[model samples]
Target: MHVVSARERLLTAALDLFAEHGVSGTSLQMIADRLGVTKAAVYHQFQSKDDIVLAVIDPALNRLGPIADEAEAQRGNAARREQVLAGVVDLVVGFRKVSATLSFDPVVMRLVRAHPALRNLQRIRRLLGGTAPDPGSRVRMAVIAGGLMMAGADPAVTGLDDEDFRDHLLAAGRRILKG
Candidate 1:
């Protein structure tokens, strides 16, 4: 049985197609085919590919928000904060290639940049602190975001099982987040 929701099916199919082909290259028709639904049904759920692009953005980012927020809030000392950051990293890297592509997509990048919700992302980044006062916070946040994207795409990390990958990434995150 198709356990995935229609919205979810479309989204999963759309992301795979979007990453593989790009926004301009992909069509609702293609997405419908990927989901084994009629074009009209897909259209009913998402007005257009643009709508799909918008819908996917937050889910992708918010995947780690709970953990990120927790880490940001729970962290007290530098060492503790680093531990929370490490949890955030593990949360993001959990999505692996999907998150990697979502991060790098020029289309989504442009959309999020213009989207009103851009504030949401900006706040998250500020919390992550792309550059810290010690000149280290900036590097850690950069490393946190960039590293998650890269680690997702890396073959070495990809080949490992979820538990193994999480363990290694947590370790990596601890070191990087602390620096």
Candidate 2:
């Protein structure tokens, strides 16, 4: 049987709590309670609430790195853009709950901005919009990024299955980026 580590459990509980309550609103105690453990147990796994928050978001950010790398490896600009957009759509659709939680939270935004992993995001944006994007590409990139995040949480799209959502998102991203 597969065993879940204490740190993994703590990070999972923290992400759930962070999703339900914004990172600022969630406490170490809340994460502990979610996992049916003491706050000291949480501390044993992570030094502070900020540490827990970082641990929670780190994996999601890490996943983006490979997408950008794969996109960069593509032969042509259109192929690279499509590859990245498709990868992003798959990620957002597959992890809609986590995406929504990370994308919309104000505290998480602040933390992510200061995080070293923020370079992954900059790289993705540069890949999508070019090394030095014009104002129009900048606007398109912003809309595609924001729209991908919102697509995960938007109630209007909830009824659609993951494949449908991903396809629609990819189409919209293509239009925005290429048009």
Candidate 3:
């Protein structure tokens, strides 16, 4: 059997708590409690809540690098846009709970906006045809991206099987991109 490290345990517990409560609402003590460890043990692994939050989110945000690269490598605008939309949909659906939690969480959003990861996120947005500087274009981008994230995270759609959920989500994303 594989052994789960203490750090992994902390991250898993943190993600769960962050999803249930906003990042600010989740404390290191809570994570330690969830893991049946002492707070000092958790601190040994991570210096602060911010560090824990960044560590929890880094893996998911790091995935955007390859997805963005693939879209950027596409030869045509339409193809690049389509590739990005598809990639974003996949990423969001794959990390459904995290995507939903991060999408609506003000604390996560603030950290994300300030963090270096925002660069890759912006690249993904631009590659997905969200590049227009106009306010309307901005709104469209938000609607499409936010909609996909929220939809995948939504409890209402959990009844659908994975394939069907992905199909509907992809179709909606395609329509939004085309507009």
Candidate 4:
């Protein structure tokens, strides 16, 4: 059954390919083949590979706002810290297949750096502070974000099912946040 629009199908396929192969490695032809369409058809929806990459990343990027807001709304420092960690864990675990790519892919990382939606990184840092004038807080936030991406992509973690993995990842994130 046809479950989604053509653009959605293209985005989905491009995301899968981008995850498997870095943006530099994925081609429009591969995306077309995944959707059983021609390269021209894919082009009809997106002007360039970069456009498809941006679109495929939009959903995940869209998630950062709510996460930042949820963490920022908390009353206490500890509460805010925990919320930030939880939101990050959910974001990473929810987008496990693409999380690593989002973190490490040069193309995606460049786009993210330019994208306005991700400006919330500053707010996320403020919310996850370690101590006043906290130099460690920034590093802590980076570690948590980077660690989740690496862990999610790690083959060793795959032996556990999704629920188990999610549980373990969340646990590890909590420990990381505490230390």
RMSD of each: 3.1, 2.0, 2.2, 2.5
Q: How should the candidates be ordered by lDDT, best one leading?
A: 3, 2, 4, 1
Worst 10 residues of 3 by lDDT: 95-104
Per-residue CA lDDT of model 3 for 1-179, tens digit only, reads 99999888888899999888878899989999999989999999999998998887777787788888999999998899888888877877677767766667787778788877567878888887678888877888999867876786688987877778888888998877766
Candidate 2 C-alpha lDDT tens digits along 51-130? 88777767767778999999999999778888888888887887787766777788777888888866777778877864
lDDT of 1 by residue, 107-174 (tens): 77787677664444444555555535776787787777677656776766656787777777777766
Point out where model 3 deviates above 4 Å: 133-138
Residue pair clashes in candidate 2: none
- Candidate achieving the largest lDDT: 3
Q: Write the per-residue lDDT of candidate 4 for residues 47-148, one digit (tens) a residue.
A: 999898888777777888888899888899889878877787777677776765556789987888899887776677677674346666656667876777
Model 2, poorest ten-residue lDDT window? Answer: 129-138
Best by TM-score: 2
Q: Give the TM-score of candidate 4.
A: 0.84
TM-score computed on alpha carbons, candidate 1: 0.77
lDDT winner between candidates 1 and 4: 4
What TM-score would every model get versus the actual structure?
0.77, 0.87, 0.86, 0.84
lDDT of 4 at 144: 75
